[model samples]
Target: MAHVDSIRKDMVILEKSEFANLRTENEKMKIELDQVKQQLVNETYRIRADSKLAINLERSRVRVTDMFTDQEKQLMETTTEFTRKDTQTKSIISETSNKIDTEIAYLKTLMESNVLETVCNLAASVFTCLQ
Candidate 1:
């Protein structure tokens, strides 16, 4: 009977040790689960922030593109206006040049006619005086 009781006591001690080890493993598993949950929360926050930033970046890009498009349109309009003005100025200059040429030719004819009339009158007076 004494030997049987000692064997029973040894069995009891082994059971307690096994129970303690199981409890320690359970605690470790719980801690690992908590860390995983925290990491998931942090990743979710980062994803949300990145999504907001991406939206803002897209908006800014659109605004800048619109501005560039407007500038391109304005530049095209300015170029067209400059070309029209240049054409008008060239036409005016050509018309003014034609007018100046006409006036110069008329003045030259008038001076030549006056000189010939004066020479003829002098010749007639000399002929009459000789007679």
Candidate 2:
């Protein structure tokens, strides 16, 4: 009977030690779970930031493209206007040159006619005086 009592006391002590070990293992497992949760949160934030950066970059590219297109349009308009003005100036110069040539020809004809009349009048006067 005494041996049976001693055996029961030993069994109780063994059970208490097992319970303590289980509690310690549970605490370690909880700490590991918390670390995993924090890592997951950090990773989620990083992904969100990367997505926002990509969106901003796309917007910037679109804006730059629009500005370049506008500039190109303005350049083309300026070139067309300059070309039109140059053509008009060339036409005016050609017309002015033609008018000057015509005026010079008319002046030469008038001078020749005057010289011939003067020679005929001088010859008639000389013939009358001799008679």
Candidate 3:
């Protein structure tokens, strides 16, 4: 009977020790789980912030693209207007040049006829003196 009581006391001690170990392990696991939860929260916040920044950058890019498109359109219109004006100026210059050429041709013909008449008159005067 005494031996049986001693065995029962040893079993109780072993069971208490096992319970203490389990409690310690449970506490460590709880601490680890808390750390994991904190990390998840931090990661979520970082992801949300990154998404917001990406959205803002995309909006800015679109706005800048629109502005560039508008500027390009305006530049094209201005270039077209200048090209039309240049063509008109060239036409005016061409007309003026043609008129000047016509006047120059007429003057050249008149000068040639006058020179021929003067030469004939001089010849006639020389012949008269010789006779």
lDDT of 3 by residue, 15-102 (tens): 5675567556656755765665566556556655665565566667776777566655655665565566556656755665566567
lDDT of 2 at 124: 61
Question: Candidate 1 regions off by >4 Å?
Answer: 1-63
**All models, RMSD in angstroms:** 56.8, 58.2, 55.1
Clashing pairs in 3: none
Q: What is candidate 2's TM-score against the reference?
A: 0.46
Candidate order, lDDT descending = 3, 1, 2
Ranking by TM-score: 2, 1, 3
lDDT of 2 by residue, 1-131 (tens): 35544754665566556556655665665566556546555654564465556556656777677656665565565556555655655565566556646654664565466446545655665676578
For model 1, which pairs clash? none
Error of 3 at 55 (Å): 25
Model 3: number of backbone collisions = 0
Best candidate per TM-score, number?
Answer: 2
Worst 10 residues of 2 by lDDT: 110-119
